[model samples]
Target chain A: MTVKAGLKNMVLKGVNLSIGYKLHGGKVLHLQKELNMELRAGELVCLVGPNGSGKSTLIRTLAGLQKPLSGSVILDGYDISAMKVPEKSQLLGIILTERNTVDNITVFEIVSMGRYNYTNWLGTIREQDRKKISKAIYLVGLHGFENRFFGSLSDGEKQRTFIAKTLASEASILLLDEPIAQLDIPNRVEIMTFLKKLTHISDYSVLVSTHELDIALKIADKIWLIIPGDKMLIGTPDEVIKSGYLDELFGNELISFK
Target chain B: MSKKYHTTLISLLIVAVICLFFLDIILGSVTIPMRHIINILFSRTDNKGWEYIIMQLRLPRALVALFAGAGLSVAGLMMQTLFRNPLAGPYVLGISSGAGLGVAIYTMLSGIIGTGAGFIISKLNYLGQVTSAIFGAVVILIIVISIVPKVKDSVSLLIVGIMFGSLATAVISVLQFFSTPQLVQKFALWTMGSLGDVNWDQHMILSIIVITGFAVAIFLIKPMNALLLGESNAVTTGIEIKKTRYLIIISSSLIAGGLTAFTGPVAFIGIAIPHIVRMLFNSSNHKITIPMSAICGAALLLICDIISQVPGRSIVLPINVLTALFGAPVVIWIIIGKKNLRTSF
Candidate 1:
């Protein structure tokens, strides 16, 4: 499946990206340097890495939450950092790892916030916005739970609510950080399957970071494997696994490919 | 709750506020009849004394109570949302102590200056006290705003605000200890929180300030709702976090500081009203919570003022005492009713 060069299907592109933090004393703490990547429309890309491998940092940089040490993340042919907050948000939706602490807010209210950029000054949800909000909630399989309190939801339900919120944002690209970290095995599989279905059914690109390598291997159209020392291995899961990078990355003792 | 239900609840609260306003006017130390009150309000009465009592005294007092209640509650709701803590209120951020310190300084200095009982001195005293209170509140507000950026979490910022309040209280106490007995008594009376202290002139100023604060809060409803999801999410949702925060701080300061300047920091209404409204509506959308809390706060404070008047007796209880006595029990009941206390936090 070769992508045509002149088409606008490339939803995200990273060129020579170096992601890390700059210290207070004018020192640069570079995590990963000189990285190039591209994600197309309708592709489910999984970013897998062990703990402290800068998976979150890379995602943050790509989502325009942090400035890369040296490169650019292009979303829809525009540099993400150069775009204004609302403009960037319109193109890319981000689901963070931290749990929201708001109480007494309903699931509908949380989902409706995804239409923040689209709503008027008063944030009045018009008919069109309502349709999108309900569609997003329905897609996340929370159709009848609109009025339920957000705080009363279980961990998996909360995760799904966040996903619905992102979906309601109507962004072409979705960047999620450890979305399934708190979910059980069934939930993890369900969410991954849902993401796969989303990519196939809709013109959306998903880049998810996870520690669940088994799920990533089974579901992801493309895998971004980041190891320690800023090493990045990107390919189809079978190619990466066949090349024995997966076994080497996690160690043969922890995981083996048949 | 459904949108229709929210609309109905808001309408009910507004109606309750109107009824409470009339009740506040009718039941005072003088115990004027409801019919007489209506007559005074609607038609010119032959009794100048009744007219003066209804128009000049009770009318202004009731209006002051209404505005102060709404202002303080709105301020509290904003602070609670800003800090993401249910207990956060107008006074929790040291604005009240700053106002107290201002009054303390004014009374003590006026005592030392030997301003004997005269018309000019009385006028100066009223103006000086309100001006000083607003100044002190703004100073503390600026300090808190500056420190907010440096603090890591809402809990730490809350602790810092508490410490600031205690520090201001200590300074006020020191001033009180050294002042004359008469001056100390005057300051003590001010600390008791009186809705009756506001004259028509002061009421006009307070109404303008409170209305402005509410307007600013209304403009911030969208950002405030975004903030409920937490700061990071709020930012990602295209809310200008710093701008929204600054607006909230300014509005909170204006509402709380202005009311405290005139009314001497009425207790419990700010902290209690928002929680009550949240529980009643079973929703946290700021669009619903802000207006409903304002109306509920006004009604509750009017009821408290009526209770303080002790209908049959001439001697009135301090407004603060009645509020704390009534509000604390409701809060306790709410806590006990909930299975998980984490929602309040």
Candidate 2:
């Protein structure tokens, strides 16, 4: 059982994956199939797609929140589907698109929730857990805002709080679904840049689905362009632009990337 | 909002609860002096009349107010959290309506079923009603529990609960239409809700159930806190969603069902007290809210009971009437005055 790890330090790998929903009468609605995706440690990847192109479905499938229609998701060396929830949680974290603003909960409390699996049955925050929670709040640039009510914070601050919660988990792989969807231009740019900085400084593998193609192209280490017909074009931003599929998907006349 | 402020507020609530507890016992149809009531409670009073008034009449009634208030409020908090709906209460899941239906069947159908059953039921009386109410509540709760696995989300389950409630109400309505006026009045009086009907034996059972419910709520604080982060986020935090949901549902049902069995589906307190406590503490931390809700709920119900007795007046209003009259305005006032009221859901 002495299998050597890969040279590139792949943190998350989706092997021959099929992503979709199981509808009424056990009818399988396949969105995409046989998609082999790789997210390496310290890499920032952006999954760009048209409105109905299954970006969220892919992220959910890879995160193991939803079962894959077929194939497997491997985390580090173990099979994701086979791993228990708490064990899988220690390795992966996700920030969903829903802005679930809990009323009356403070930023500190929300971030402390990331330590749920690590805490005792009573969810007591030990000194070490407290330090990690504080560090996470600081890392997300929300130091003084810790005691502020989550509902009172701005949308940007709220998103940062959620990110802080995810960061507190110390998961190596982070998946975000439309993290900056509702933000204004400035806040959007700030969140994207903050995520970019996170990937560079830490051994975290980040995958975010976004409609902000320009920012994604500018900062992403790799661009995964999903188009119609359940197909994905995976490569560096330069390779994606040079391939001319980006222009074709946007239709050369309406909106060209290059 | 500060820890110190919360401490001060909690202390204030405890003092209010104690004072109200005494006030509730002191201000019934026959107002008794504090000293006399104390002497009676401690068994040192020679005034048999005051002693009887305090011990037999007002004492059990006041205790009912306290236990029902606290238990129902905690149950309401759980339902609100589980459903993420501001209007959700202990009755939202149709547990109360099911209890009502159970009562409706017992009170109205017994005579029609024949004199043998009616004789037994008449002899059983209060015990029969409590048994029937519990049976009804447990039945609806079991049905709701069975549907939990089938539903995809909490919202769907909330709808299912509402549907079951409506179904129970419809059945009760048909029974009412066909029954005699006196029997219908008996059922109607039960619907008006009461804190005075529970005897000492029932009080012992209610106390045990409410105390156990509080203990279970304490154990659920962590998982409930995790749930404050929406369902998906909660799952990411390694919370067992199905297990947590089951614990919350069963515990809330036990408290709400037990209280309804004794108190005839006491209204408003269950749904309103949680909101008031949340608004007062300005914290959604279950650690703080659960205990605070208990105290505030107990205080509110005692106040309601005092008002219902009308001090020197012999006429007593229904408990539900006073609760809705007072509970509605207070919740409205808090929501209106406090613009920064956070949505605890």
Candidate 3:
């Protein structure tokens, strides 16, 4: 895809980016190199790749959790590396793959923590913050589970709670790592449908990483396929499928597209 | 729990603390009547004998138990939250053992150096023991803080802390092995722990240190709540994990070090009261737990002190022995009753 001229509404952009690690002996371990990407408002993009294909590394680099080996990730045209944590958190909400270990906290309390950046030193929830928390929980269909302990929730419910937490943050761009990895088929479909609905209802730009290729093909506006040899193919699902890159990316033995 | 329930629980705990305070002051071996106790507390009575017993003996002991109990419990709660471990406590990072080693060194060498060693043991008396214990605790704290930055995982740091504690205990045991019988007996008595040794001046200092530590702890409640989600989540929440960790370490050190320096490592209260509070409140919100744990801790220790005094009996049991006997059973019951032990607050 060509780089567009208007960049005002762009939530995220990566220019000449190489995402990977720097070794102790001063060696740079580059996973993927010379990447250019842009995520716009109200777009749901899916990032898919094989195992050990640096999908998590790319997400981490984009979320400003780690520094790029070269170039930069620009969020709202500001360099993500230059921004403070609170400033970055205000613009980007991240959902990690790790299961939350916090126990004995109610769902409402977990959702309210998304206001960490906006709240005062004591983290007192204002009336407006409560409204936002309730709305987020309602959006994820967890309105009645407010007082339930997070530890007692099912895996699907836990995933929804995390999404509610991210929604409560009110960040324009949401980055999720395997958001539906642990969900059943019904929950997976529901979550995908909800993500798709969120883009239409609100100006949220979501970039999600997942292995469910069929769901991504149906729901994502743009698909980011990490092909072998440190390259990425970015286009609409139809464009990529017609280009025959998905077949080349995953061999016939491992996967066959319907 | 609802706000109303929280308020009610806190109120009941406060009332219990008040009742336990009176029980601790009134029910000692001498059989001082409740009226005389009240009179001695309120009026400037000319009865010198009763005044001396109530004011000098019972008052300081009760105050010591209250402060030491509150301090140790707060320290334990902070440690458990900071490390995200169920077994973590005030002594997990070698603070108590460091204090024990300090007392052992003092008692063993005070005999060897004779009474003429003015700076070491001759002049300060109880003050000297407190100073040395604090010094030793601070030393171990510095070592732990220095190592914390190098270790990436909290579990690894917890293991290192346990190793440091074991090292301190081994050194103390060696000191005990070679010391004179009289010196060994004094150190053994200190190990058994006593709240009656503190005077009014020491009480003033202990209260000041404990209050400061608790203030720091209260200020850290928000960050600690964030930390319950684990370190990466906390970082994503815009909390500076390094700064919060250092504050927790310093606050815990202050409270545990002060209490151990004074009360000679009073056991069970530090490790048990937070669990009790969590169970009773049915939540792990640090804002609620921290203050409630302090009140419950004070009450629990006051009850234990009353039990140690044995009501009308002249023989006072060691505080450590009674704490373990009382506390271990409750902990076992909590473990048995909990259906999901892994998620225990």
Candidate 4:
């Protein structure tokens, strides 16, 4: 793992980033601040935190979907704020928590949206685009479900479809917001395992915010653990576990980690 | 829907539209013969009276019906897609109500200013009404659109829209109360929504606005498709949500406002035609639905216009009455019959 870390190149870096929302009257509701972090190539990093621990804010800030209250995020050595949406999308993909309620859209069409930046003004899918879409659907194990309505899918299938959509972009980095929050145990395990394999197969960096710490610990190369009102704890899963911060933050009299 | 099947369906719709167009022209008060109508359109006809009736009145009215139908339907589709609310339509959004209010205010102004200014106002009638209606629709749309981001959900936005419509109606009532009886009757007639009221000059303006609106909607095909996944997801896919929203609002207002200006708040067609197209096409891809909705809408309106004329009789019913009679039931059918709506919406 140390040797693998040595070979991995840094894909995303946050320098002195502050994550929060600004309320009215020029007041800033700070969540976390001055935290520097790095996501390396071919690494699946899990961001585990309690509810309202600013995990989503961090993910959104990192994805460039929301602005950082202070400091900056660098993607492939370029400032993310300076890049156009298309240019940023080419390098970074985001899977939001919002359920796609569009009932008439097919799985194929939903997956095809991943190629938005690559498609023409008419969004006409060429030969290359078709191959990418098919490959993405196949990657999610939804090969024959292309023409099926997205709303007809099981929760696991739907989440996999979203993952497929993110993959179809050919983005070097992915930021998923609570991807498996609504899934069953099997689905969660399946998604985490797939994400782990994906990082191993390709030099794609994944930063997924999830509450499923056990699955994340089993699959993630690095853990970004937010302990609330304190600096985030980042290290290998074993290292984080050994630090005793996990027990101090999450353990209780009735429920404690072994 | 497969590509081949879609092509077949589209061709059938085009044929239906053509048949309806001719039928609309032929079945007016006099019931002009189909061959004579065809010859009147393509070549000279010997009968001056028939030629004048077909050319001057029926032809223009049919043309108005065609454009108005297409415009209103496409506008409704845009609203439904943009808000992601199946119930959303131009009328529901208070766009037409705004137009009605504008015309009411104009009539009130004419009444207050008396006969000295009445002649000038009447002279400026269609142009004045069109400008005011467009202005009013745009204002209401802007208000509704600006509130979109602030609202928590589409249900709230829809409620806000309905409230705005009610507000406009209330204001129009006040104007009607103050206006002269003659002006009130004129505005009332306008409210019933007649396609035959528009002259060639007014039709030319309506056609220009509606076509421009359609052109804009076509340009929005890609962004709209991206938006089907909802705005946040659409943004991740590199769609500029603000710009797309503005374009959609502009295009919809142009079409809805222009149609209302000419036809006086023709209802049902705007809201119903999109669902019909969606059901017929079995797909929500904007490319297929947009053009298909336009064609289907045109055909529906022409049929409505024919029915409104009350064929073989001198009396003509209001266009709004027929559209509501047809459109409401179709919408109900879509809701109840297609249980897939829960999935699609």
Best by DockQ: 4
lDDT (0 to 1) per candidate? 0.85, 0.87, 0.86, 0.87
Q: Report how far off residue B20 is in candidate 2 (Å).
A: 1.1
Q: What's model 2's lDDT at B153?
A: 89
Give the per-residue lDDT digits (tens) of candidate 4, residues A143-244: 999999887789999988888988898786889999999999988899888988888877678999998878888889999998788889999999988988
Q: Model 4: how far is B133 from its true place, Å? A: 2.0
Candidate 1, residue B325: CA error in Å?
0.6
DockQ (CA atoms), all models: 0.56, 0.63, 0.62, 0.73
Residue-level lDDT of model 2, residues A1-258, one tens digit each, is 122233237589999988999999999988888899899977899999888889999998898888999999999888998888888887788998865558679999999988988998889999999999999999989999988988888899999999999889878789999999989999999999998888777767899999998999999999999866857889999999998887777655677777
Instruction: Output the better candidate (3/4) by TM-score.
Output: 4
The list of candidate 4 runs beyond 4 A from truth reads A1-10, B1-4, B117-123, B138-163
Q: Which 10-residue window in model 3 chain B sums to the lowest lDDT?
A: B114-123
TM-scores of the candidates are: 0.93, 0.95, 0.94, 0.94
Write model 3 residue lDDT over B251-273, tens digit each, in one string.
98899988888888888888888
Query: In candidate 4, what are the lDDT values of residues B186-295, reduced to their tens digit?
Result: 88988889898777887788889899999999999999998899878888988877778778878888888879988888889988998998888888999888998899
lDDT of 2 by residue, B1-345 (tens): 568998898899899999999889889787677788888898678898888788888989999999988999999999988887888999999988999899999988675764667677777877888999999999999999999999988889999999999999999999999999888998889888888887787788988987888888888999899888888888888887888888898889999999999888777888888888887777778988898888988999999999999999899999999999988998788778877544665
lDDT of 1 at A192: 88
Candidate 3 clashes: the total is 0
Question: Measured with DockQ on alpha carbons, how good is candidate 4?
Answer: 0.73
